[model samples]
Every structure is written in C-alpha cells, then in structure tokens.
Target: MSKMIKPWIKLIALIIALPILSYISLRVGVIPVGHTDVLALGSDASSQAMIALNDNRIPRTVVALLVGSVLGLAGLLFQLVTRNPLASPDILAVNAGASLAIVLVTLFGFSSIASFTSAALVGAFIAGVIVYLLSANGGNVMYMTLAGASLAALFSSFTQSIIAYEEGALDEVLFWLTGSVAGRSLALVTTLLPWMIVASLCVLLISKELETLSLGDQVARSLGQNVGVIKFVAVTLAVVLSAFGVALAGPIAFVGLLAPHLARYMFGTAFFARLAGSALLGSVLLLSADIFGRLVLFPREVTVGVVLAVIGGAFFIYLVSARQGVFKS
Candidate 1:
C-alpha cells in the first residue's frame, strides 16, 4: 500500500504546496494585500498596492515559475545527455553566453526585450556548438566542463568590462546581472509565456528519447535511436529554454542543478516523473525565495539572483562534498 501510494503522496504534497506558496506570495509583500479583502483593492488606498500586486508581484512570481521550470528541465536534459550529474545550463556556458549578449545589447543602449532575447538565443546556440565540438574529441565531460568554464569566465569578464567602461549604463547592467523581478510588467509576461509553454512541451515530448539515451550510446543505438540526432535536438531545445529564461530573468543559478537532483531523490529514475517533479520543485523554491526576500527587507526588496546565489552557493558546496564519488569518474 505504501509503495502504491508513494507517488500519489508526493504529487499531492507538491500540488498542495504550489498554490499555497503562490497565495502567500501574492499576499505577503511590503504592502499587505489581504487574501479576503477586495475592498481595499477597489479603494484609492489600494491604488499603489494594486499596481504593485498586478504589475510587479504577479508577473515576477509567474516569471519565477517559468524560469525555474526551464532551468530544471534544461539541467535534467544536460545531465542525462552527458551522464554527468553536474552538467547544467550554466556549466555548459549557455547562461554566460546569453548574459554576455544581453550585456552587449544594453551597452549599446538597446533595451528592447525582442533584441535581447534574439541575441541571447543566438549566443546560446553558438556556445552549445562550441561545447559540443570541444567535448566530441573523446566525449570527455571534464574537458567539456573545463572548456565551458573558460568560455563563461571569458564572457563574464567581457560583461564586467562593459559595465566598467559604460558609466551611464552601469545601473542597468548591475540590475540585470543581479537578476531582479522588481519592476516587471504583465506585458513582459505575455511576451515570454508562449515561448516557455512551447519549450516545456518540447521537453516533455522528448523525455522518452532522453530516457533511452541514458542507457549509453551503444545501447541507445542498438535500440534504434538516432543517437546523434536525438542528442542534438535535446541539447538544442535545452539551450533555447535556458536562453529564454536568461533573457527574461537574468542568469539564475542552481535551480537547474538543484531541482533535477531533488526530484530524482524524491521520485527515483523515471525521466518524466523526475521532470515534472523538478519543474514544480523549482518553481516552489524560486517563488519561496522571492517571497522570503520581500519579507526580509520589508520596503526594500532583494534581487532574486542575490538570494539564489547565497543559497545556491552553500547548496552547491554541500552537493560537491557529498557527490564526490559521482564526479570522480
């Protein structure tokens, strides 16, 4: 009975938590929006509060969910494809490439989302190709990670250089680099939702292929999977998803790295189960963090990236210490 009910239990728990967290997120800001009071929402007292809720809080929360889900799925894909638990969008330099592109666009005084998103997508694609080429020599995950790290560092340096030289754009660069959701609008949400939905569906549809590929290239090949094509498609989809998230939310860290493993720890090795669970978990983590940030500072909200970086940094260290065996290979 316990065995039979376990999956349902996990699903139910997540289902219960997601809405509750989202509700609490909606209510607990610097200016309180009561769960039951729609009167204030109609009055002049609620004008600024309404604007904050509808424009800033709601969109940021939604973006958190989308960004978290994208990172989780992308991380899962990269890990599966490389058979490396540590492989993620950031590790592949996709985030760095997208970030670099965005920084370049901003440096040139281009603030349009369309321009930034397109540039980021292109940059991410290029980074993925480079990582693929560098790793193809002997399928060495270490070499690939090293090459990606080098590229990330290089791009990061370039981004820093731009911020240093462009005094006028310093504030914009800093805000973007730190990953804020402070002044997001519903229009931004409208612009990015379709892409997130399509990308998520693509990830879901490719889960079986990913599962097959996990068994090893020889096994996947013997099973009639076009190993190369499947890997390419999966990686490309993952990169696009990551790039979109970066363009929208800046380069959020560790949701990708942390979510899939947390899902695996909870749900075992089933790819679809892990994928869905990770998406939910990622959303919960990011939204919860964002909410916590708001409450912690009261009137002054902290950036989501700053909160995640501190948490992710500690979590990453713990993961490294505990999972040395996995990386030793």
Candidate 2:
C-alpha cells in the first residue's frame, strides 16, 4: 500500500495539470485568442475568441481526452486478457474495423454520426470475433497478433481502394485516417459521451475478474471464475469503447499501446492501480499532444495523431529492443 502512494500522487498531479495545459494551449493558436480574451468575453475580438474557444478548441480537447482515456482502458483490457503488452486495439484490428466501417459509410454519402457509430460497432465486433477465433485455436498470442495484423492490413487495403476510386471521399477519409480533432463539432462529443461512460462502468466492473484471470486460466477456473464469460465481456466492452472512439475521433493510435505500459511501469503491474494510472496518463498524453500541435504550428494546426505516431514509433522501437522478454509468460 505504501509503495503505491507515489504513482497515485503522480497520476493525480497529471489529471490536475492537463486542463491547465489545455487552457493555455487553447489560447496560443494563430487566431491569437489569449486567456484574457477567454475570460473577458465582452469586446468584439474577445467575443469571437470566446466562440472559437468554445466551439472549436473546447470540443477538440474534450474529444482528445476522452478518446485517449478510452483507448488506454481498452488496451489495458486487451493486454490483461492476452497477457501481452503488445496487444492493443489498433494492433488487434479493432481500429481497422472501425475505420473500414466509417470509410464505407463515407463512400456512400452517409455522414450521420448515428450511422458512423453503428457501423463502427458492428465492424469492431466482427473483427474482434475473428481475432478471438484465430487466437483461441492454440491459445497462442503470436498467432492472434499475426491474424489481427493480417486482417487489419486487408481492411486497410480495402479502405484505400475505396478512397482511390472516389475522389470526393478523399478529403474526409484522409483526415479521419490520419486521425484529427480539427473541425470536430460539439455534437461529436455529445454523441460519444454516453457510450464512453457506459463502457467505462463495464470496465470497472470487470477489473477484479481481470486480475484473477491474470493469474492463469487454471487458477481462475479453480477459483470459480467463468473464464470464457469474463473474456467475452471484457472483449465486448473493449471493442465497443474502441469503436466509438474511432467513430468519433478517427483511428488515433499508440494511446492504447503506450498508456497501459506507462501505467504498469509506474504502478508495478497491479490491476486497479494500472487501470487508474493509465487512464490519467492517457488523458495527459493526448491533451499534451494536442496542446503541442496547437503551439507548434500556430494558425495552421497539425493533428495529435501525427505527433503521437512519430513519438510512439520511436518509443515502440526502444521498448521492443530493451524489453524483449517483458511479455513472456
């Protein structure tokens, strides 16, 4: 218990600091809306700034935080189930499923949020089922990863072909594929909030079962746990949460891959501790990236996904090289 205190404190500090950083970054864009302008909301310039802050920056920031946290939670769940740190939504074809669904919808000229959400959910579930079947054959993690990667590659290829044939869909698909919070509306945040909340509750409910399952299937079964049921529930929740995130924010990567590992590094692999810590860390990681994007380019903004990809790619290489045996069970 005493050993856990430091990580919790760090997590708290990150949670508190994220909003402050987001606030500052919100004002630092090329439009030149300062903190004072946000506060005032009186002068004409201030009024426009307020509108931009509320209508643009606020929604994007909120989406980043929510999507990041969701991906982190989903990744943690996947890793625990597979007992592999490399198992993440993106790695396992969950994001690919959602992206394919959205691309199909976009190609058909169906841009409604509801349609996007439904398609993504279906796609993610189907992809997860396929991966599960492939992995469960021999209970082999390597097989699962390979199968997922193949499925993701196939789906991504299909998506690219669709984009190639339809010039009108290029801009929308490109932005989504790269992952961006730019031009996101408040309605997207609203549409995604309830799904996130429900899925989060489900994740919390399964935390104890996940901890037990981590002890091995024989131990879990001996302890009266329904291993199959628990796996289904956890995977379902992860897929749903990840689908909604991809639908709302596009296929943002690495938040899911990195957040849980960071949490474990800080919290020593305890289940609840890693869960909570990763949630906070994920939020901070994403918000910080979004803030950096705002500051670095100023008026012409870059996507948070672009920033994370570069950082995450380098970090992944370092992790794989330094900790080759970390995931061995």
TM-score of each: 0.92, 0.92
Best by lDDT: 2
For every candidate in turn, the CA RMSD to the true structure comes to 2.4, 2.4
- Give model 2's TM-score versus the native structure: 0.92
Candidate 2 Cα deviation (angstroms), residue 36: 1.5
What lDDT score goes with residue 215 in model 2?
Answer: 92
Report the Cα lDDT for candidate 2.
0.81
Write candidate 2's Cα lDDT for 133-182 as tens digits.
88887667668778888988988898888888886766767777888766
lDDT for each of the candidates?
0.80, 0.81
Lowest summed-lDDT stretch of 10 residues in model 1? 37-46
Residue 28, model 2, lDDT: 64
RMSD of 2: 2.4
